[model samples]
Target: MSTPTKVPLGSLPLPLSSHTLTKNLTPDRTAASPKAFRQVQHSQPSTQRRARLLSPETHFSYVAPNPLPFPFKIVPEEGEDVSPANQAELIERWLAAREALQEKDITERSNGLRLHFPAGREQPRELIGLSETGLRDCLPHLDVGDAFDLLGLPRLTKDPTNEEPQETENPARRELIDILSGYATLINVEEDVDKSWAPWSLRYSGHQFGTWAGQLGDGRAISILATPHPSNAELTYELQLKGAGRTPFSRGADGLAVVRSSIREFLCAEAMHALGIPTTRSLSLISLPELPVLRERIERACVLTRVAPSFIRIGSFESLNPPESMFFLGGGQQEKDLEALRILGKWVGRRVLKLEGIKWREEGQAGDAWGRQLVLESARRNAKMVAGWQAYGFMHGVINTDNVSIMGLTIDYGPYAFMDVFNPYHICNHSDGEGRYSYQAQPSVVMYALRSLLTSLSPLIGAENALGNKAVSPGWAKDMSDEQFAEWRKQGNDLVLAELEDTFQDTCAEEYRRLMHKRLGLRRIDLDDESKLIRPLTSLLAEHRLDFHSTFRRLAYFKPSLVDSPASTGNLESSKADFDAFVESLMALTPEPQMVDTFKAKIDWKKWLEKYSERIESEKGLWDADEDVDLQRERAMRDANPRFVLRQWVLEEVIKKVEQDTKSGRRVLGKVLQMACSPFEPWGAEDNLSPTDILDDEVLEERRYCGIGEQQMLGFQCSCSS
Candidate 1:
């Protein structure tokens, strides 16, 4: 057992500016008063418009150092040239590196846990040059707000020419845009610049669809830069390029992405952030017309610049112990593998989770305690994240262990969709034929991924058992007898698993309840309302195939006064007619609604509406005393239920326009992005004149972006290949 290092307790201070912090960390989000709700409703959009300018001295200078800022080594020495000298030797080294990584010492090349190398065997530099497209300028305003402000990056004017003519006239914005868009390198010696940023690919393995898929690493993704956060030096933000080129891990397929998937990922990342969900933000999306890629067909290639605190995944920890399947290709040294696991877990504890002030004991109990807490933290974050996804009707479509971010940020966007219809059992990814990652199953699957993460960290977490005693050799799982180790492992695993499940369930339930109640305009949780109103509401929506987003927003317009008056038969009849009219507005009618559909839907909907209205009337006083509670509730509902979501059909339209005509597509993309950034805001005359199909006609503008698509497009699904 290795001795634990005792470090003093420390705290990560919040950013000086509140706008720089994530939505979760902001204290104002928890305020329950109507005044606070109004403040929050306006604060987010205002924050999106504001930018914190960077000082000129540090703005353009590269902040990242040579070999990257992370605490790891890509090569044995600082300037070792491991690159093969000849084409024949390149293949030999590639084959040998794979074999060595699996069977021999995995960290022989790099001292750290991660096996870092270039993008491909022949392509020494992992940073691929990308061509600038019309969409380059459009990304600076993709609703990310001031996220990139702290990176010492330029804050582009809303309109380069109209808003800030000098910004467009100057060359600084253009030069920086080229860097982020991948048209230039980070450290340009030609210009005498020396930021020393190096790009590298990482190696990790995972369990794919419940089966151990050995050595599934970053095949198409490359980490281009990692720099200390301007607000807190302790934190670092990594910039990664998706679809840069093939890495050694690209098994047998071309490592490229088409504009179809790139645009979806690019828009979805920013949209998710705007919705106040924790996600990896997109900095830029650049199209390479000369770089055509083959998917279902040959499509123009593109690269998406992704930003996040950490890119570590559940598969990262799982890769520590090579599975039996790897033996077929080669084998792994168990001792070295376990050592790498310990190193990686410790690094994550201190760096990623930011655990500080732990009293390290000689027996290594501190590592166990930290590891256990890491699992709990991950569980809580994921629970809340999945809850947000459920509240917004989002389906990740791909929830493989490899895709699960350890920090719980929504990463690896692929074939993801926000449901048009409210169906609990909706499956957004057609490739998921078994429905393993269905909307209803997302919470459980996230739990499954967490369990996999826990299993990988069990050896470190099991150093000390629940009884606070060293049950086996502190950091080694195989030191004791097979029977004894199994017993010890079972006891430790059970203890941690129990705590994780409690955290996951409690956090998920609380967050989901809070979000749902807010969207429904309730002041607080009410079991009666849940059973009689909320539960029935879902059943009715699903029965009618009603659009999830529009239903919640339209329900805000329901006038409780119409049905809250005295229960006279004559009055009830007149109120019932008005109620029926309101109910018709909520229905997702396309082409022409069937009389039978409306008649049958109204029966269940009216029953639900009566219960809902009664609950709302009862809660009026609880909502607000100083203001009009009805108006307050309506405002709160509108704030919670966005008027726009980056739906699949909308993404298809945007992508098509960009592919057909880049010049006109820029305007369409920019307008849609603006709407995504301020989703709760109503479409107005300002938006009615945009040169896009979405705003071609003022009368149909809201329907184009806010309304549900045709019945056939309601439950649209896509394959994982997308």
Candidate 2:
């Protein structure tokens, strides 16, 4: 197909500025450029940037990739069109676009780094996607030869020009991968970033397995300060230093992470984000050679940079001196703790949620009007986030209050898994002994967590300052009896939980139904359609022990149409023969034949297929009525259900390869990363998008082994030892 020609809008050549990973593409060498290099000395993170939010002036700060890969580059002249119409283009076109440059046209210069915070103030730098910077070279795949040591990790060793670190902070070596993997050796934590910028610890309270665990805070995770993103200057990220050091919140163990756990998080974080799931983005992952920690065995230390708008959780509100305890006990201290909590709540709401009118100037009930609205917004985002999790087979092993993001992104990725099998009750996290955070229980757990948040915010909702004043002769007023108090109590109950529960239930159901509709390729969602189609498929999948993703892909090949039922035939033997033949025909459309057949052998596929056929027939006229309907239906279904999910077996094999040969391992991982990251690319030349079709035979053979020694990964035990 010929690519569509795009009309140019401006004559001003668009400059491609980036601190990219270098790749020696010449004869003897090949390299991948990291990020854009920032020359000039250290600058304060003050709001002293030259550009502001949504401004037309494209500054040096907005140079990094936001929705796309950071390490990629763009040049002047013929800019690439990334519209849906050009989705079928080769991946190499993107790789070669940057180097397709003009010598004189490209003016190489650095716009001395800009800061977001005020000058000369110690601020906390919470680690984020370790924006690619300072790396003179990029990492080679497993093809680099047998090299499995800390030395092979990607880092910024020096400036390419060997320019003295005059403008940029002394061009120091930055082993981003190892640093992010929780290795403390790569970065110099002792170096003072700024007079005002200093690392700080976060503290909050949360429930673990339905039990409230008090004073759980950032043990190893410390926030340095919010820095301007490579893409957006107005949007700042907290550069959290996870496993950097010990804080008061460091419960009882040393603040460090293991390589095994670090790599898993690094891969899963990007994988989730690529799949369009709201999650904390990972910038870099690094491993330390000699730094070993005791878990189940001697595992090397690793660090990961998990980037987010903010790391605040639902527990952040609960930690406030809440009025719930006082309301229940009656008569309490008139402390201003709840007032502070409300202030922070407003900041989070305005900064992140972009909701207006949160200023707490109003007195009494008016001062806390945003409280109920806050709960509703939080509920809506969490509902959608969890729904994404459910659709993609993500099992967040630990769903504690602290683990739940106020921003509604997946946080604290410990023992989480993109499940291999289609068991609704499957517990991916081994630490979740009671299965409270299992695949099926995610929605309920989130709802329950929200309810707790409401309980913590009750004080700000017109509950009067009860310090020492009250209608008291014996704690009761003679003018107003218990009747007046009872009325007040009832009104308070109405303000907190009543409307909020309705909002939570409605939003969750709506989001979930939206996802289900997509997965089933159904245009409309109703009780009839759900009962007749979606729900039945879910039940049948669980009963058959099928893989969720593969089974859905298999269903994409068949379009629904009303057909003669075998039972309609008068001859019983003939009917049986018809049923068998029907099943065989339907099975022919199946993807991943051997795996599907293993599950099909035990199930009543004939009956299930009949029900599904009836469903498609119900919507025969709604959509897919044309002769090309087969193409349209398949496109819709494939769009809704991704053929690739980061299954445990696949990830485990990749991990093992990395451990054996980082060179070859990196190459295979790069291929896997492409598929795992973007699941919605247009159909390739082969008319098949499955990675199993494209990967090397060795890798494909290993991917097929779902069993871990003896038992399958469904029973695999993973813990939060890191």
Tell me the lDDT of candidate 2: 0.51
**Alpha-carbon RMSD, each predicted model:** 14.4, 17.1
What's the TM for model 1? 0.73
**lDDT by residue for model 2 (404-441), tens:** 98878898888888765567888877777789999999
Candidate with maximal TM-score:
1
Maximum-lDDT candidate:
1
- Candidate 1, residues 1-722, lDDT tens digits: the string is 33322211011122222112111111112222223422322233121111121121110111111111111112333444555554333333333332211212132211112212222222211112121221122122122222222122111112333332112222334333333434343321111112112244454667666666666566567665554443345655666777755544455545566678877887787778777777887766666666657678778767777777778788777766443333322122222255456555555666677665554334544322577777888898899899899888889988988888888889899979997767899999988889889999999999999988887777556655543642223345435465654564566577699899999999998898888899999886876666777778888777776778878888888777666555643587787678768877666432335523777887787777777878787786686589887788888988898888888788888788778865445455656766676788865432344546453343355446665665667678987877
Stretches of candidate 2 exceeding 4 Å from the true structure: 1-195, 228-234, 322-336, 357-368, 463-493, 561-603, 618-627, 680-711
Clashing pairs in 1: 8-357, 9-357, 103-331
